[model samples]
Target: MFIFVILGLLVCTEAQGISAGTPVFVLKGEDLLLNVTKAVVLGKFDDFSWKCNKSNIVRFTFNDKGASPHYTGRIEFPENNFSVKLKNLQEADSGVYTAVVMKDSGDETEAKYSVKVQDRASLPLLTVSSVSESSSSCSFTVTCSSQDSHINSTFTCDTRTCSQEGGERSEGIPDTFLQVYQSSGSIICNHSNHVSWTNDTNTIKDVCHQQDDPEGLSVCLVKTCVFSVGLIIMVSAVITVHLMEKLNKNK
Candidate 1:
């Protein structure tokens, strides 16, 4: 029973080690530092190796360190620690990396990391689809987009404050998203991924005031036309009254 229990524990430990890898995200063309989570003692271990997708990339003995030829100029292995600095990461370089240590007694230890490389998100586009005005508030619909993703949302603003209405609608792209939200009296459209983000913005007050300009000009023109017509009618009535009084006096 004691031997069986020890074997079961070892199996469980190995399973946990493989499944509980740390997750790291880096942008394409950037560098990353993969740190070893397990403590290392160079004197206690006979060999150390770092593997990617089960293929060895670096190996270390007590006195020397070497890397595979494919990664010779792209990786830096420091002597003071077991950390590896990967330079100019590409999307193809994303994979599970494992650090394996072999003790002199033939026992093995491992630390695992899962790395992802992503591109920076594109700039978001924002446009007003429609606008309506009332005595108390102004309401508008806006569309925000980036690459293949888009979101549509509505905003209502009064003289002092603004709020979103009917929530938001969105279509997403893989590994990226579009979001519309309000901040500091401005509506912001943001496009984002794990690596980077970009945004576009417009002020609520400015949009509402622009919509008001045309309506204001129309109102001014109507008032001026009414005043001019009334003045012409009054002048014609006075001329007819004067001509009738003169004809009656002459008769």
Candidate 2:
């Protein structure tokens, strides 16, 4: 049975005569719509069928034979329509899908598709590697990490923009891509796939501390001054008390 199924797929793939639009990217676990042009004369065609990865997914016949049992209840075929709707898609469902319309005259109309199931890109991470300042400008080196932590890329940012320097891409990660953009004083690192995208942003002033210092420096300075004043007051009071006691004892 498996051998026959594989052979059937091979035959269908080879028999696929016409192709449609570019590959469709669909989010995993969502419904997918595989479109096929509606036959002009609904009564002329004897059977309309759909296949995924060359496996018979559903079929509709003029005789009311119904769809294939494998996709029963999970698939929808509107009356007189060649399009198909698949629900609760999984990664396994990602593949080439074909639709074939067979007419009473023995003619067939076909269309092919390459469907990809992807998940929305997760949030990425941005890290600062180093910051250097000059009289004129500040330069910063930053790293962006993929959502899955599989790919790490380094980029350099000047006053204007951020550009990629180097990176390592790991195998077996699906639908991974990296992008960097700088706007105003902010640098954004974006990670995406065909289905979705996510990004992390950092401001130039925060990373490089371009001015006198970061806001945190003011707080540190305040704390240091308070501590020094408290210490000096305590020492002065102790010395004054000691000298008064000595003078009284001498008297």
Candidate 3:
């Protein structure tokens, strides 16, 4: 079996050349899989080796296991598998990864990957605009925007509740969401991406304050008009009476 495995590894190395694929992005402190399982294989490969930036990472020998001291505690590989799992990743871990496989028949294949470790999303910014309010209710528009341009959403709120209106979101990427609530004439905006969050609050009391009823104001105005008209009529009647009295005395 040892002789056959060595023969297979030699043949595979001669037949296969290095190939690269699209780059992959992973969040820091997240798990990453260096995948190499897509190639067509005649049978199960016995010898597997993984590398980082062209430096040896780990290898499964027929009789023993070997791993680089740098990745001693942070890597895992299943028996006879070419793929590897890296756990608790860090920013410094981003680099080129390569996987090599050798079959028992001396045929080999290679797979390469470029990795990028990204930081957690930053605190989002919530902006409020187009605010219109009345004595009984308030209406406003809000937008939750992120500096990364990966997240952007619009929302609308009233005294009762707030709801999502429209927005843009990234595909195949983690999403950020927004929520709004009203309390005591204030609107609170919350922006969250599961890992981080931020908030913006605004008060509508200046624009939407408790107000007297419209019917009450109309009634008061009507009462004043009626009183003024009645007083004018009474004064005119008294003047006419005095003028008639003077004319009679003069005659």
Candidate 4:
């Protein structure tokens, strides 16, 4: 009997820990609705209350209801259910919220939620750092940046398709991520979190063609210099040979 009781207590503690760790993500200035999964019958329960970080935010009895002064105008309890709606969530409001129920039969039930409020992710920026082109293919290096994070990735593209040479690159914040990848003919930089996402895109053809003009001009200049040097050398050699023949004839 003693062993069975100890096992039962351990199981109950584990279950409670799992429930208390339920994560809820919300955007800043957004409203969050927290619901109790278990049924709450008014007549069977003596009282119920909702607490945040161990501080009571709302309390309800069979006939009476009250809310904490700190949450006076920002909370709502709907008549249709035992759900609490929190409005205008801010970073300061992020905490663990628990709903507790006390029954007349000396029983208690509780549900916990861990809430995190975050701002929307900023827009991502994509820039090409260097590009190389050949007759059949083009390759380039690009950097993707968002906020304080950045990633560098290389891509190769042909006439028909584009592929990433070193796969995708990514950086992560607490709950946010920045990534660079290829899709279709474009390279995309994405910044995202559980609440919001943004991206920037550029085409492979456009980036490669932009670099080709300067490279082509440099190649043309080199070819012109080589041809001019060759012509000058040939003319000098012919003049020297003609002079030598004339001098020999005079002698």
Candidate 5:
């Protein structure tokens, strides 16, 4: 049951970063048996720091059980020689880990390992709204949000319809889905309303898709009818002249 237990209170959420050293990770309550004598953190030196203290660890803020929790963790090196086990994990308990190693000559090497908990994929709330109405289509925008203050994620937008998304947000308003077409659950049915690039548009117009096309098509109908009537008149005049010539010849 010998394990290196790093306390869970240290989440990296400030301007000061970890010292230029190695990082390591171990479960809070998990027991591990090491076949090798040592382990250390490995990866890029810039994004994380190594060690088990405030100067050497990175913090991740997450939600836990009914409350919130913080993860102050570091990466440990040389995992192949040792085995690790975890007891309990919370939202504040993500295992994105790396390690840094310093040799006698002062040159550094990095080891990397990713600690991912499979059970927690908290889907944020997705909100869709109609913005404006255009001639042909409608657009809806979607936004995802989480209650935790520390987790800011970049969002990617996509849908089966022809609607598009623009301006990816990482700080706030992670993503938005534009409601363009009037589908089963849509609030409106106008192309302009459905195809806005932002989520804050307050316009709620529902121009009919079929009505717009018909108005444009009416111009073509007028030309077609005129041509048809002209052809009929020409045929009628020619037939009348021929009938008169035949009757006069017979008389």
Candidate 6:
């Protein structure tokens, strides 16, 4: 029993009573195309399926579909090819596609397609909340969080932990002091490739003013000004009273 195959560009297995088949390997997040150049007779395949493998992983499958009867005509590739769709696949989906050919002449041809999957980076994140304006006397807290993580690692993180900082990561509470000259109300935050950042790119579009001081709304600044003015008035009054007492005592 011999199997003869018609492959393009490569001719190596063409001997009588010889049956040969090979396996194809593709990477993750990728597609692959395969064709039988050699003639595989009908009536030989009992079972055919796909299987994927990774570390600490074993055989895997995609579609457990059988054939459509032997050789009504050979299925051409690329136009309706099986190999072209194996590109840019996922790591969990990487595996082997086994094709079993049962020949009427008591011969069998077995072929396989092996694939490897890759990782793709996802979009970033954005959040807006409170800042120094939340309170005039108390502290205000604002935080940004991202959704990306290292797919293959173990981690423990606080609000500021990132994938690049292996193992456990903790972020310290930060308090940034800024002059509240105006009410800057808008915030922009971004999360990209497992990283997070923020800014006031909205140009502080809308800052509501206090009813008492419509022109200047920052209570922190107003309080400081009131304290300074009161101190100055008290000092001036004390100096004038002391001068009057001295003049009266001299007379």
Better of 1 and 6 by TM-score: 1
Q: Give me candidate 5's TM-score against the actual structure.
A: 0.28
User: Which candidate ranks first by TM-score, i.e. highest?
Assistant: 4
- The residue pairs that clash in candidate 2, if any, are none
Count of backbone clashes, every candidate in sequence: 0, 0, 5, 0, 46, 34
The superposed Cα distance between candidate 2 and the true structure at residue 233, in angstroms, equals 34
Error of 6 at 34 (Å): 2.9
lDDT of 1 by residue, 1-251 (tens): 99999999999988886785777889999998777866787773488888888888888888888999989799987547778888899999999988888776674646788888988888989998689987767889998988797778998876666779642535476667788998876889988888998899987767886334433444566889999999999999999999999999999
Give the TM-score ranking, best first: 4, 1, 2, 3, 5, 6
Using TM-score as the measure, name the better of candidate 2 and candidate 5: 2
Question: What is model 4's C-alpha RMSD?
Answer: 11.4
Q: Where does candidate 3 clash, by residue pair?
A: 8-106, 11-106, 12-106, 12-107, 12-108
**Residue 160's C-alpha lDDT in candidate 4?**
61
Cα-based RMSD of the predictions, in order?
9.6, 12.1, 15.0, 11.4, 15.7, 17.8
lDDT of the candidates, in the order given: 0.81, 0.70, 0.63, 0.82, 0.35, 0.34
The digit string of per-residue lDDT tens for model 2 on 35-140 reads 7765533464466778787678887676664666777777876545667789888878888888766675774646677888887787888777667666445666
Model 4: which residue pairs collide? none
TM-score winner between candidates 4 and 6: 4
State the weakest 10-residue window (summed lDDT) of model 2. Answer: 209-218
State the lDDT of candidate 6 residue by residue for 110-214, as single tens digits: 445444333332232322234233222211222333333211112121222112112122232221111111122333332222122232222232321222233
- Give the range of the ten consecutive residues with the poorest summed lDDT in model 6: 173-182
Model 3 poorest 10 in a row by lDDT:
207-216
Measure candidate 2: CA RMSD: 12.1
